[model samples]
Target: MTLTHFTFCSAFILGLMGLTFHRTHLLSALLCLEGTMLSLYLASSLWSSSFVLSTTSITPMLILTFSACEAGTGLSLMVATARTYGNDKLHNLNLLQC
Candidate 1:
């Protein structure tokens, strides 16, 4: 397959898998969110690589940085929640009546 076709196929698969996996625990959902972000970054990079210069590089770097921070914060929060509540299921969050 060509570059464009490969990009499209991979983006589609990653997006689909991300959506599908987002309904699980906090870590899985966070990972899925990251996967979706990666898909968007890859598609944008591949599509614009033919015309633009490195103007797009800054955005991807920022996105990567933000995603890393987000994942770290999420993991920390998950650890705290699990330590307090004994589990990390999304539904378990609703058990917090306070």
Candidate 2:
């Protein structure tokens, strides 16, 4: 109901829409995936902050770390696709052909 929550939800939805509409470009999909992950991270952090518990949680850090790894992997895939196919179009990519 809060502004931050609304913003986070909007960002997440926009990222999903980007992924859906930009399915042709690998780079765009990667960027959208990162955006989705970032929004999830922000929302999780906000939710965690609402709990005034005795112990601290590292959920946000873990989410960030995994997102970074996912981004690196996606970038590597994009580079490989570009080098092999001359473009980053997902339609031209055929992993099963190899």
Candidate 3:
């Protein structure tokens, strides 16, 4: 409805598409995930601002903290995968074979 809403929605959709299209690379997927999280953070912050009755909602902070943790974990996984497989390709992360 509003410009902010449209912006956030489009950003989220673009991030989702990027994640899908870039699934072959671990780094790109992680970046897309981060972008999605950023859009979510912006949306949540905007929503929280409307609730003037309360001082402020902790949703934005919580999302930020979770995103940071997710980024750290994803980076570590990518680094480990690259070291183990010589490249960070998602297809190479197979666990079925012994």
- Candidate number with greatest lDDT: 3
Model 3 clash pairs are none
For this target, which candidate reaches the highest TM-score against the unseen true structure?
3
Instruction: State every prediction's TM-score relative to the real structure.
Output: 0.69, 0.88, 0.92
Model 2 root mean square deviation, Cα atoms: 1.9
Which lDDT tens digits does candidate 2 get at residues 19-49?
9998989999999999999999988888778
lDDT of each: 0.75, 0.90, 0.93
Candidate 3: regions farther than 4 A off: 53-56
Of the two candidates 2 and 3, the one with more favorable lDDT, higher being better, is 3
Prediction 1 global C-alpha lDDT = 0.75
RMSD of 1: 3.2
**Candidate 2 at 80: error in angstroms?**
0.9
Shift of residue 45 alpha carbon in model 2, Å:
1.2
